[model samples]
Target: MTTPTLSRRLVAEGLGTLLLVATVVGSGIMADRLSADTAVSLLGNTLPTGAILVVLITILGPVSGAHFNPAVTLVFWIRRDLASREAFAYVAAQIAGGLAGTVLAHAMFELPLVQASQTVRSGAGQWLAEVVATFGLLAAILGGLKHARQAVPWLVGLYITAAYWFTASTSFANPAVAIARAASDTFAGIRPLDVPAFVLCQAGGAVLALAVMSWLLGDALRDPEVA
Candidate 1:
């Protein structure tokens, strides 16, 4: 098969991110509207996000490596799997897709087109959780690439599914997702003020993951996976 052009790869990244965030925001809205129980709403939010992730990654992986998350893209950039210029494009596409995803979800739900979230998701505990959550995410991707390339989608889906409950920040582990969520006032939203910190911590965690994975996998880092 011929290589996908840069434009096609960028489109895949944007589309994948759009769908992923739409699932997150859309499901959260549906769950919140349908249930009084926060736990039920969360469960509602988690499943579709995870399921869509698996689907999106599986379908778009070949096109863009399915680096729907800017954090994930950063990892590949650091590994030289992608160049600095292309990584920036990927991140820009992800961020734009994420914002559009929020708008799309709001439109579907008949909510405001643009909203600044009042949902305050901050504090050291959650910030630390973001770090851990992102770290684990990169670890999953890196490890799965090494031993189970075919299972990467499932690995990421399962990891986020579990992380949603375990981590205080619901494993937003993605800068694109986090920023997009800040545009929402729904159950899945985070305050816009909190997004920068989350993004920073996620970036830190991704870099940390690379360091640890490089050491842990030693010579195995010789072959870096696309996503």
Candidate 2:
């Protein structure tokens, strides 16, 4: 197969972020309205979020490397999996897609678009949680891709689901996703002021994951086992 161009990668990032944020905001609204219990609402958010993640990954992986998350881009950039120029293009597309996704989600749900969430992320614990969540997400993405190609979507879905359930931060590992999710005041939304901290932790996680992956998959990095 021929190598994909930077423009192609930007398109993929744009499309992937669009679908991801739309699914997240859409599912969060549906879950909130449909479920009476808090548990069910959370589960409802997770189920669709996981499903859509797989779908998006399946569709966009080949074109833009399916790097819907800024953290993933950073990790790949450090590892030489992606070029600096492509990384910049992907990030720009992801941010644009995030804004567009928020707008679309609000319009679709008839919800008022706001810059804050009902829930605010604060405290050292939450910061640590963000780190853990991003680390796990990057780890899964990097390591799982080693042995399996066709199974990527399912693997990503499972990883996301587990992150949602296990991490206190609910695994908003993607800086683009977190920023987009912050565009609304819904259950899935986060605060704009809180975004910087979370994004920082996410970057840190990516760096940590890169180091670990480098140590563990030195051969794979030199000669990739999976695309």
Highest TM-score among the candidates is held by which one? 1
- For 66-185, candidate 1 gives per-residue lDDT tens digits of 889999988888888888989999999999999999999999999999999999999999999999999999999998889899999999999999999999989999999999999999
Taking the tens digit of each residue's C-alpha lDDT, what string does model 2 give over 87-168? 7887889989987888788889887755567678867877888888888777777777776668878887888898888887
Using lDDT as the measure, the top candidate is 1
Structural similarity to truth (TM-score) of each candidate? 0.97, 0.93
Off by over 4 Å in 2: 222-227
> Clashing pairs in model 2?
none
- Name the regions of candidate 1 deviating beyond 4 angstroms: 222-225
State the local distance difference test value for candidate 1: 0.92
Model 1 TM-score?
0.97
lDDT for 75 in candidate 2 is 79
